[model samples]
Target: MRSFTTIFIALFCLGFVFGQTQGNDVLAMGRKVKKPKILSIEECKKIAQQEYNLHLGFHQKDTANYNLLKGAAITDWTIYLGIDDLPFAVEFLFAKHGLGVFTVVVCMRAERRYDILDGGSILMTEVLKRHPDAEAKLTISCLPQWFDTLRNKGYEVDERTPYRLYYFENLSSHFFVVFDLKKNGKREEVVIDLYNGFIQNIMPEWKTLEDLKRAQINFKPEPLPEMPKPKEKQEPKGKSSFPPEGKWEFSVTGVPGFLMSDLGKECAAVACTDVMIYWDNNGYLDDSDEQTYANDFCAYWGTNGRATYSQIYSGMPYVAEKHNDCYVPNGGGIRENASWAEAIQYFEALTQELGAQHPMVLNDYWPAPPHANCCIGLYGTGDDKSTWRYYRYDGINQLPQPLTVWRSSDQKWRPTAYVSGYCVGLPTVVWTSPLKGDENIDIGVQVQIHFSKKMNTSSVESQITITPEYARSYQWDPEQTTLMIIIQNPQQDLKFLTQYTIKIPATVEDITGKKLDGDKDGKWEGSPEDDYLFSFTTRGPKVSFTMVPSTHIESKTGCPPPNVQFTKFSRAILENKERRPFKVSFTAQESGEGSYELLVNELNLPEHATLCTLALKLTFTGNYHIDANANFSESIQGRDGIQITAPVDASVITQISCPNSPVPDNDWPDDNYSITNPSYPTPWFIDTESKVGILLNGFCAGMGHLLGRFKIPTVLVNTDLRILGTY
Candidate 1:
């Protein structure tokens, strides 16, 4: 009989190679190897086309030797699933008994560039939308253990939530779970294990629900029907070209004293074809202390040139007269004594009945003004040494002209030599020497003082004067005390005792305005006519600490130690040029002798950047003192009853990865890096009896490998085993 049916299939291939050398038992070696019984659906579509042709020949033979060049490369995900109008024999009997008999063959890549691999066809479209006759037996059988445990985890990890968690453990026994892989998604928890899956656990405690009615079905958010509602056209209204007395546009620019007090409060109506009255002081008037800026711009608006003709025919009309006549015989212009056609006929008789013009608008960043002397540069000046410098352009253009810069009285800036790309006003400059009683020989000049952009502020309690002048042989030095207080915006791992607030400054008040009280012995009580002088702030702005070493180490007991600290005057150690510091040492996860403060949180900066203060160096087997804000909530302390709180001294320790681990390589450090150390302040136990239980390692350097887990609650040798590593 065909050689007795080949001797009964050669004794079932010698009893499956004698049950795989039966040794390190996984159920006594898959129970004497028989398997292969996924009955119907065309034998699970011939084993999902032989596991997608062996995952397309190992992704085209390991994508031409991985990391070609450096970063970016992944781009080949063809997962088409099935369904739509069914009928290809009921979509091939529900994709071969629902996803080719619980799929299994998988493949993956990515050893760097932020390891990320995600789940496949979202659990075969949630098992064929919940099982249309078990969609040929659910994704040919659970999408090959969900893409072979996230392609054997190799970097780029995130099967989703808490790193992709979905328990389901057990719920009685009548389980007709058809489909639900995130319907109307927005998840945080969803555990259901129905027993056969070994009591699956998904309990990292966190609540706040409202919907997802236990995923039995009935989910919402689908709405997109009634297509026929788009008809609302109505707009036939008119009459309004916007000009019933609002368009007398007149713009000029030669230095109109920084544009007359914000353009006279933005042109408050003049009523005559609309209005727009602007001016310019290119005729000289840039306050440099001339009797305190002409007594504060003559107590407010009304001097420094132009104006006067009944104060401009009574305030409002329309006179745009940008100034610039070019004259510097000891500069100080009012037109250096009128001449540009008598200063344009005294500015058209002060805007004769409303309407004047002159250069109109040709500013080019501000030009015109260069006719005396010729070559004296400097540049930039808006304050501190009163801006305005450039002297050398007599007439034929070499750039720079309009001159008249001043503002002296020790604030300095009196350089008169105008003529090139103009705009300078400090006036006051003359030498005209005949040596007549020469005290450095000078004629009639000194009138260059200015300041009048509509001033206002003079009642300083009636300009006071209470002289006392009384001094004898006084000696009150408590050893000559020295004061110092300055601390603002310091950041770089700063969080020791945590408590910050500083405002003080009422100009250091005291003469009753309070603020200088430290008495008893901290000094300060106040006496030199005390005018507020408490200040206090120097011990702040400066923090630095370190610890980084986890580009994927996984085992070797627990490798991570670099130790670093810095505080009050701890020089510098540096490292966050894009963040890296992550070593927290362990100290049995802390408990008593108080001290763990590591809270470093820089992330997204640049609003005027400022974060510098990190000094952490804890290397003690006992006898510590470097908490500099690494504060581990008074160190753990939760034995026996097990309820320990407070332990988040952070420095980057967010573990919770599994499905095999390794996903995210470009050498880890993102999600904005740094923030996870002995960080277990709220129930992070899992180490049951410790066979090195809490391992979760995933630092990444083409390392992280298992990417598909979320169980937690460990025990190890006593037989708990839900270890599933990486973070």
Candidate 2:
């Protein structure tokens, strides 16, 4: 027993030493290897092909079938290659920074098929480890078992559905498995960690059938039958079909059956819901339910009773504002007294605009009970006084029924005798471009306004007013109901930094003569006469400057000492002149008369004139009138030394308005508002080219120091300005 124990210990020590040596050799090799460098596109393709073949033990010779795609993120590329005689393809992702192999994905082309490789990460790690310099740290998140697991979890995934397996790097590595749910056409994306098989998240990719087919790899769809061409024969001039013959009964899917509700008379609500649901199914709107939509819409329009054309027009904007994605143009109520011919025209227009046959909601389908229904189809024209057939939806209990109405000699339909009025829901614009209060508008910019209903061109043209107006032309898009005002000739290219107001009065009317009134105020002011006002400030010349109170000067001194000599002091003012300086001074007064003074140095005085200071008094603090000759007398040189004359006829004005107080900074009136921290710092200056004053405010702090700055664009420079104190 003792001899056996000794032999066991010896064997254990030998094994430990060998293990340590092997570890040390590994560390040495790692240290000797340099970091990998980025590989060229061709080199990466070659490496990927080699790795794939070496691991699979199959030589793929169809190099032409390889596709190289650059990733959306930088320094990432994928090489996709197909296997010979197999309905599968291999995708290799390479991180360009270190030429690292991120992942390898095998995708099958068969429907409902999963090309998951067991121990795919292990295989990748092994293959990458063959390179002495490579740092292989691969993880397989898309194993074949995941499909079975999802199926067990009640997810409908099949081989017929398209899927994608890709790798992404965001700080750390990750793998994604994306597959379509064949039952509902929704794409499911599952994210998993690269190092572990744990799922990080599962999200749905909202892609349409066409989008999926376009993005799917190796997806060759079956050809569709060609559409039959229309016959070349022209119909008789007076025998035209309103909806064309065959298209009268087109079906709209996903519309809910009409149901009576305590929520209110919901015919309009149901009809609107039908249109919304149909559009949603066709991928034009987000998913929504009819009850919730109707409830919300009724609440918005204040509809407690029977909905009318006025209410529909007013309420349509609210619907658009809430569900902008589902809002369509001309989708509001038609005119109350619209003629049958007019109604048919609008129906045809709506169908063409929506690119589908949409049902038209009629307020009074049955005259006896004042019932509402939808008109789905139309036939024949009023030109020949022929009978018109309307495919109507009465309720969910029955299919659409054909109602025939004879056209009288006056081009009127017989339905008018029983129905009081007609109303059809249409689309409208609840918003517009160049939103209100927009500033720095370009001089050459065209004005665009969107509307919910088709407008009467003549009415809209007459109601629009552009202040500081220019010669403009109008462009109307009947389909979009968008009015574009083009500046044929602007008034001096729109003055820079000047505000221009666009007024669209309530006089504007829609095609049905209903004035614009989106607010349902029982007033015309909401639409054509609603006094819709919007203004924008044109950008000033790039090179412009604004005068502001100088913070540095104001802080150090109070308005020029009451009686100090003007020549000896440095007056806070702006002087811009070639030879003679033009000085502007601001002064404040408590109760005494306002005054203006002019002083010139003896050396810079006019050659023949004597230099002397002149002062003029004003009665009030406001702007005073100045007459050069009346304000000052000619100069007298030393009581008769030479009788040098001064220029008294100069165009200098004696009226100098008392300067208002400097405007406070934006951060003023804080808890620490004090004289010690005067509202504005002195010496504020702004360049017009970069900065612009948007608003100026001021109060009297002392005499002659009006301080304020116009707000400017924040991007140009610092927002704060120092007002210079001047006297």
lDDT winner? 2
Model 2 / residue 664 / CA error / Å? 83
Each prediction's Cα lDDT score? 0.22, 0.38
Candidate 1 accuracy as TM-score: 0.15
Instruction: Give the Å shift of residue 272 in candidate 2.
Output: 2.5
Models 1 onward score TM values of 0.15, 0.25
lDDT of 1 at 184: 39
> lDDT of candidate 1?
0.22
* RMSD per model, one decimal: 47.7, 32.1
Query: Tens digit of lDDT per residue, candidate 1, span 70-123?
Result: 122121111111011000110111122113222221111111111111112111
**Distance from true position, residue 452, model 1, in Å?**
17
Task: Report the number of clashing residue pairs per model.
Answer: 130, 61
Error of 1 at 422 (Å): 26
Candidate 2 has a TM-score of 0.25
